[model samples]
Every structure is written in structure tokens, then in C-alpha cells.
Target: MSERTPFRWHIAVFLAPAVVIYTLVMIIPLFATLDLSLYSATETGTKFVGLENFRTLFGDAHWAEQFWNAFWNNVWFFLINMAVQNPVGIALAALLSLPRLRFAALYRSAIFVPTILSFVIVGFVWKLILSPIWGIAPSMLAAIGLRHLFEPWLGQETTALTTVALISVWQFIGIPMMLIYAALLSIPEEVIEAAEVDGITGMAQFWKIKLPLILPSIGIISILTFVGNFNAFDLIYVAQGALAGPDFSTDILGTFMYRTFFGFQLQLGDPNMGATIASVMFFIILIGVCLYLFGIQRRLRRYQF
Candidate 1:
């Protein structure tokens, strides 16, 4: 072997494919979309409108109201997932991570089955289950003398958004559960033994020791939940359609963008408006991620051991 160090072309070679693909697929498209938002389609094709498209999105009463409504709805959707999914996932993960838990693998597989399913499949399956016509929700409720409680949850203004949010939570809970479980498993056995020796057993050990150590993992899951929930589209689209129907009660930014871009029933498509909506969503996600990383994550001191 030569004494001189060889040139490190391997690193560049390995990264080239991923870098090229990302630039072409993600970066180029993102910039293109941003550029597209600046131009509005007219009779003679697209016209440069600068910030006029954005102003129309936020200033026009008709568009502004819908945009704000969708933004708020997206926030609520994200909040519900954060509240429901993470806790349930953590609880299930904690339970399964226990040393003596029976059939742990089977339970994990069963719980994770939903995550393996496509969004289209999950949405349609839930839609059928919750459908007023052929859905089993009413009958299932009736079986327990709670039939009176059933009322097309997916079709009502009061419950439509929340019901859809919960459906999303159910379908994706496996991700956090798997992540937390992995974190829990990574905890050193010696540390647990030490905790046991100090009379910290069972729930005490989990809450006082394991939880603190795994907090970084929880933070990661929380941020992921925020990002995914805010950007969600396929589930709601498949279940409620692009209009987010029943008086647009379930309308979120994703569906709103779809409706703006494609038009539905009466409304004509507006590409400039659609791009503006998309730009807004991108910023919202960016802000959320920044907050999580700089605000929440900074305070969560991760332990090496």
C-alpha cells in the first residue's frame, strides 16, 4: 500500500445519486412551485402578478374566509393527533416493552398492521365502517345500547373534523409506538437493575427513569406527528373527498389546496391560488419544525447511556 492517503472520491460517489435525485425531484419542484405562485392564469395564459395572488388569498373576503378556515382546521387536525396518537402510542409501547409481556411480537405486528396499509385503503375502510348506509358504526353502537349515540359522525359539522382526525390517529399510531418501543429497548439493562435495587420497580421505574431517558424519542415522535398531520391529504381526500364535504366542515389546508387547484362542483380551478395555499402550508410546516427543534428539542437533554 502507498504511504500517501488516497483521494476520497468514494464519499462523493456515494452521495452523488441521492444529491442529484433530491435536487431534481424535491428542490427543483419546490422552487418551481414557488415561482408558479407568482404568476396567475389569464385568458392569454399565465400572467405575472407578483404578490397579487397572495393578497387575493388573504385579502378577498371569499378566499380569505375559506383560507383561514382551512388553516384553523389543519391546526385542529394536528392538535388532535398530537393529543391522541402520541399518548396511546407511548402507553402501548411501554406495555409491550415490559420484560414479561406475553406475545409481544404478535401484539406489535397486529398494532402495526394499519401503518402498513395505504392511505387510500385506510380511508375507504374507515369510511365504510363509519358510513351511515352500509357502515357498521351504527350497528356496533346499537349492539351496546348506544345506537342513539350514532349519527353519521363523518357527515356532521360538529364531529366530522374530529372523527377524521381520530381515524388518522388510529391508522398512524403504530409509528410512534414502534419508535418509542425501540427507544425503550435501547435502555441499558444495568440501569433497570440499578433502579430495581433502589426499589424503583414497575410503573415507578418507567415514570421516573425510563420516561426521562426516552424523552428525546418522544420529542421526535411529537414533531413527526405535527409534520405528518399538517401535511395529511390522501386520508381525508379518500374519505370525505377533495371538497371536505358536509358544508366543508372537514376542510384542511391539504384539501383546500386540492380544491383550489382542481376545482370542485361549482368553483373553477385557480393555479395561482393553489400555489399560494401550498406556499402557506410549506411555511406553516417550516415554522412548526423550527419551533420543535429550537424550542422543545433544545430543552430535552438526551442522555448518552
Candidate 2:
């Protein structure tokens, strides 16, 4: 019988620093937050309330209204990215992957540069650009004779959330594009040659062959978008403030938790309730990932070529 290799003590040594840092920053805080959710502050001190906070969040009318509003907004935010960003990304990737495409790298870099920029910067810059008073959007529209279409989009309740979501899409579309681009490039040359022999060329080739093989990549991008979008805070906060205003039309779970945990203008901070909100967000993300991993991923794997 073959003997097992000796334990790699050096491997553990190399991993120790990263493990320690992650535990300190991520793991410990996660557990602490979860623990904090079970208690509520009292005049005397604190009281263990079990799931009472969660009940208040969902059952109480005031909290329920805000919670549902934030929840629905978050859902819309994710849906926009899924519908617009990913499809556009796929299209861009298909074009960039074309063999004869010129300056593909330049196009890729330009598109991807926004993804690397700080969300705060992107949000703040867009906010300034869209300002009704002195912003360039009105001027740019007037230049093209479309000035009549201009409005205070960022300040309007009806358009504010959608505008922010599209801005997010514009900034992050490059991620799915790059990921799918890599997936496309990884397709075996032999497969392309075989498809060519079969007279499956151009869009027909992509629709049937490339698309099927890249379904797994799309699935991965979708899940990542879900997790990231659900956890999104920086951009919305930067553009709309802590209240996520225009009458809280842009508030998502992250912002909701932030306001609850940290306090806003008049709302006093309630750490226990805030922790409950955060816990709920964590579970929402968890369920989503699990659904994708166990359910959608299995189906995606079947289409892998």
C-alpha cells in the first residue's frame, strides 16, 4: 500500500496570516453580530429576547413598511443588473472575443476601468453630472437638441433608484464581460474547428455552441451579482445619503441596516435590531447562493460542453 504524504506544516504556516486576519475581521464579527441579534436593550441593562426583534421587524407595521420597501428596492436593484448589465456584458464579450476585432484590449481596459474605481467616486461623480442646476447632463442634452427630455432624475422619487441602479450596471458590467471573455477564450480550439466543419459559423455558432459552454460562467456571474448587489451600500449611500432618499425610494437592506445600527438624523441607533436586520440580510444572501449552487448550478453543469 502507498503511504500518505507527510503533513505539510509549511503550508499551514503560509496560510496562518491570512486565516488570522480573516477570522479577526470577518468570522469573529459575523458570529458576534449573530449573537447580538438575540438581545434587546432595556432601561435596566439588556434583555435576551430571542426572535422578538425579528418579529418586530416583520410584524410591526412601522418596521414592516420600511423593511418591505427596502427589500423590494434591493430586489429591483439586483434585477436591473441581471437584466441589463449581464446581457450587455455578454454582448460585449462576444464582440471582444471575435478573432479579427481590432484594439480589443483597449476596449476591454476602458470598460473595466470603472469596475476598479471606488464606488463612492462613481456615485458622487454621477450625482454631480446629473445635477439639475449646474451639471453637464442638461448641457449635453441641449447640445443634441434633446434638452426637453432632461429632468432632475437623481432627485425624483420615480427615477432615482432606477438611475442609481443603471449607474451601478454601467460601472460593473465589465466584470461579467471579463469573466465571460475568459470563458470564451478557454473553449478548446478543436471544438471551434469541428463546429466550422459542420457549417455552424457566426452567430449560429455562438447561439448553439459557445452559449451552451458559457452557461456555467453566466451562472457564476449571476450569483456573484446577487451577493454583491444585495450587500450593496457604498454607491447608494454616496449618491443618496444615509436615508437613501427621495423619500427613501433607494433604500436597500444594507442601507436599512446601516441606518438602524448607526442612527440617522432622528432615529436612534438600536444595535440589537440592527444586528437582526443584518442577520436577515446574511440569510437572504445565503439562501440565494444555496439556491443557485444546489439547484441552478446543477442544471448549468448539464449544458457545459
Candidate 3:
């Protein structure tokens, strides 16, 4: 019998650093937060409360109102990104990927530049531009004779969340565009040639061939968008404050968690409650990812090509 080769311990050795770092930064913190959520600080000391915090979040009137409002707001935020940003990104990617497109590199770079900008800067700049008193948006609208359509979008409750969501979309559209663009470019030239020979060309080729192949990438982008939307705090906080106002109309879980953890305005900090919120967020993201993996991803048949 031939001698069996020694197990490749080198693979484990090579992966050890990454595994250690991820454990230290991600896994440890996650479990710690979960642990923290089970305790509450009292006058004496921290005491285990089990699921009391969760009950308070769901059953307490004020807490439940804020939580549901933020939850629905977050869902709307993700939906807006999914509806507007991804389709726009895909369309832009398709146009850029066309044969003999002029100045393609410049167009791509120009469109992607906003993605690298700091959230603070983007929020501040957009705030200035949308300021009702002296913003350029009003001026530009007036110049086009459509000034009547211009409202104080960021200031009004009805429009604040949508305005901020669109701003986020503007800042991040490049991500899905680049991801989808790469997916498009990775399609085998042989596949294109074969399709053309079968009289599948142009839009038909993209719809029947390229689009199917890129469904996996689109799915990835959707999950990412979902997670990012739920985790969103910076822009909302920067633009709308920790209360996520126009009367908390823009409040999402991230901002809610931040205010709870850090103590905003007159409210005192409650680390345990904050951790509970964080745990809820963790579970929400986990459930979304699991559904995508087990339900959606399995059904998406990836072609060998």
C-alpha cells in the first residue's frame, strides 16, 4: 500500500493569524455584547435580568413605539436603496461595459468618487445644499422654473428620511456598480460568442445570458444593502442628530442604539439596554443573512461558465 501523505498543517498555520484576529475583534465582542445584554445595572451593582430588557423593549409603550418606528424606517431605507441604487448601478454598469464606450474609465471614476468621501463631509455638504434659506438646490430649481416642487426636504418629517436615504444611495451607488461591473466583465468571451452564433445579441443577450449569470452578485449586493441599512447611523446622526428627528421620524436601530448607549440630551445612558438593542440588531442581520443563504442563495443556480 502506498504511504499516505502527512496532513497539511500548513493550511491551518497560514490561516491562524486571520482566525485569531477575527476571534479577538468580532467573535469575542459579539459574545460579550450578548452577555452584557443579560445584565442590568442597579443601585447596588450589575444584576442578571435574563430577558427583562427584551420584554421592556417590546412591551413597554414608549420603547415599543420607538423600536417599531425605527424598524419600519430601516426597512424603508433598505427598500429605497434596493429600488433606486442597485438598478441605477446595474444600468450604469451595463452602459459602461458596452463595447467601444468612450471615456469609460473617466465616467467610472467620476461616478465612483463619492464613494470614497467621508460620511461627515457628505452629510454636512448635502445639509448646506438643502438648507431652505440659502441652499443652491432652491436656486437651481428656481432657475429651471420648477422651484415650486422644491421643499425643505431635510427639515420636514415626511421627506427627511427619504432625503437622507437618497443621499446615502448617492454616496454608495458606486459599490454595487463596481461589483456588478466586475461580474459582467468576468463572463466568458466564449459564452458571448456562442450566444451571438445562436442569434442572441444586444439586450436579449444581457437579459437571457448576462443577467442570469450575475444574479448571484445581485443577491450579494442585496444582502449587503440590507445589513448596511440596518447598521446605518452616521449619516442620520450627523444630519438628523441622535434623536433622528423631525420628531424621530428618521430614527433607525443604529441611532436608537447610540442614543440609548451614550445618553443623549436629557436621557441617561443604559449600557445593558443598549447591548440588548445591539443583540437585537445582531439577530436581525443574522436572520436576514440566513434566509438569503438557505432560501434565496440555494435557489439561485450558478452556471459553471
Candidate 4:
């Protein structure tokens, strides 16, 4: 018999199953959606309409207004998370990772518990806590002599989006905390000791040494937060429903797409329009990721040590 080739095909064979699954599930669906966006359904079944769906999504007065509103609302939601969540997460992580801190593990575990929860559970739990019928939030505010602060925050147009953003921040803070904590832990003890010996202790050491070394990690966390915030959906959908009620004050791209594609209370679904919306969302996410990777990430200098 001829000698067998030395190189084995085992690695490719093992990887083939995963690659096939991903291609079929993700890649195929994405392309199919794109293809469907080019055609509109009618009594005669789907007919090729080229760019008509996109034109209507962007140019028609009624559809365009709702599309823009949802798009802007999504942007606002993302901005709030970036403004509130990352700083708070970084602060908590820094404090918890501090040397000689007591009960650090317990605090970490408690804070991270929310992140492990399902979006539906977290949404309903917060909804109940904030509901006027339950009066839990008002009761707490009254206890602090701030009863005037109480209102149906989630039902009000002014506060609904902010309330939802804060809820998301609360749920996901643990992610950044854990990531940053791990990065902090990776710093060598010898380096920290050297900083202490150089008359740099306490906050000074952290600002000068620790902060510089962890900048790369911070950059990474910021990009991750950016992507996650942009892609957010489930919590808002669960808490506010697909309509994102109170006059659509809480509507984001995801809910908007659902309403447009699947129809709501009285409206009819439009698959082509839905596909257009999905395509827009895909581009938005792609742009944000590219900006982070090429613009922000390239400028960050990761230390070799």
C-alpha cells in the first residue's frame, strides 16, 4: 500500500460542522433577507420592485417619519448607556479590584447576578417595581421625602426612554466590571510594588500607573459597550411591548422593525419595508464597529508587559 500523507485532515473535519451551521443559519438568512428586500408582495405574490421599498422607507412622509424617530431614539438610548454605564462600571470595578478590599468577592457576585438574569425576567421585575399600581417607586421616594419625584416614569413621554436606558445600564454593568476587573488583575504585582516604592500610592498610583496600563482594556470595553448598546432590543420590547407605547415615545429600531414587518394592533405587515429597516440597522452597526476598530482602537497603545 502507498504511504499515507503525514498531515492530518482532522482539524478541518472538526471545524466543518460549526462552519456549516453558521453559514446556513446566519449567512444564508442575511442574504435571503437582502434578496427579499428587493421584492414586494402583492395579490399576485412577490414582484421585483428594485429600490421602491427603500424609497418608501426613506422618502414617504408617514413611513419616513416613524423610521427617523426610531433611528434617533435608538441613538439616544445608546448615548445614555455610554454616558452612564461605562463610567459607573469602571468605577465599581476599580474599587472592587483595589488591594485589601473587604468582601470584594461578595460585592462582585451580587452586582453580577443581574447580568445573569434573562431579559424578560429583568424587564417584568423592573416594570412591576416601577408600576404606579404597585406604588413601589413612589413609596421609596416618599420615604426619602421626595414624593414629588414620583410619577409613572415609564409611562411618561419625558422619562420613558431614560428609565429604560437606566434599567439596561443596571442589568449590564456587571459585564464591564468583570472585564475591567480581570484586566486590572492581570497587572503584575511587582509593577504595582515598584510604583508604591516610587512614592506613588493610593489614588496617585492608580492614576499614573494603573490607569495607563489598563487603557487598552478600557478601549476594548468601550467598543463592546458601543456594539451592545446599538444592538439592544429585548428589554425595551418586553417592558414597553412592540408598540413601545405612550405615543411611541420608547420606540427604537428593533421595535420599529417588528411593527413594520410583523404589524401591530391595527396595521398590516410589510416584508419589504421590514427588510429595508433591517438593512439600515445592519449598516449602522457596521459603521460603529468600523469606527471603533480603525479610528479608536488603532490609537490605543497596548503595553507589552
Q: What is the C-alpha RMSD of each candidate to the true structure, in Å?
A: 2.2, 2.2, 2.3, 2.0
Instruction: Choose 2 or 3, whichever is better by lDDT.
Output: 2
- What does candidate 1's lDDT look like per residue over 45-116, in tens digits? 998989888999999999999999988998899999999999999999999999988899999999999999
Q: Is candidate 2 or candidate 4 better by lDDT?
A: 2
Q: How good is model 2 by TM-score?
A: 0.94
Q: Could you give candidate 4's per-residue lDDT for residues 191-221 as a string of tens digits?
A: 9999988889988987899888888888888
Count: clashes, candidate 4: 0
Better of 1 and 4 by lDDT: 1
User: Whole-model lDDT for model 2 versus the true structure?
Assistant: 0.95
Segments in model 2 whose C-alpha atoms lie over 4 Å from true places? 1-12
| Candidate number that wins on lDDT, 1 or 3 | 3
Q: Between candidates 1 and 2, which one is better according to TM-score?
A: 2
lDDT of each: 0.91, 0.95, 0.94, 0.88
lDDT of 3 by residue, 147-189 (tens): 8999999999999999999999999999999999999999999
Output the worst ten-in-a-row residue range by lDDT, candidate 4. 296-305
* Per-residue lDDT of candidate 2, residues 1-305 (tens digit): 39888898999999999999999999999989998999999999899999999999999999999999999999999999999999999999999999988999999999999999998899988988999978599999999999999999999999999999999999999999999999999999999999999999999999999999999999999999999999999999999999999999999999999999999888899999999999999899999999999999998887766
TM-score of each: 0.93, 0.94, 0.93, 0.93
lDDT of 3 at 114: 93
Best by lDDT: 2
> What TM-score does candidate 1 get on C-alpha atoms?
0.93
